[model samples]
Target: AALIVCVLVLELIVRQFPAFVIELTVWGLHKEIENKEVNVADKEAEAKHQQHLARFCRK
Candidate 1:
């Protein structure tokens, strides 16, 4: 639901601004910083910005 939209927005933003992506990764560890990241401190909060992106492996 709303989580999906948030995920999409952050995904796009990270793509456009990679620096923010890194900051977001570490920030996830601290719930307090989550809000500073993007008002996502509680479960009711949007569930975007997952930990891993799951990159593909080509060999």
Candidate 2:
């Protein structure tokens, strides 16, 4: 009886482990996407500022 209970618990954990890993992977991907968006926004702002400066210099 004890052995059966232990096996059941191990099987439950094994089934749930993949779900946990998938959730963790999705969370990590979300963070990576957010960081990339911030970096892209910063680069765009810098490019716009450089263009403005160039126009001013031309005038």
* RMSD after CA superposition, every candidate: 20.4, 7.6
TM-score per candidate: 0.29, 0.52
Model-by-model lDDT, in order? 0.62, 0.95
- The 10-residue segment of model 1 with minimum total lDDT is 50-59
Task: Return model 2's CA RMSD, one decimal.
Answer: 7.6
Candidate 2 local lDDT, 1-59, one digit each (tens): 99999999999878998997898899999999999999999999999999999999999
- Quote the positional error of residue 8 for candidate 2 in Å: 24
TM-score of 2: 0.52
Error of 1 at 52 (Å): 65
Which candidate gets the maximum lDDT versus the true structure?
2
RMSD of 1: 20.4
Error of 2 at 32 (Å): 0.4
Estimate candidate 1's alpha-carbon lDDT, on a 0 to 1 scale. Answer: 0.62
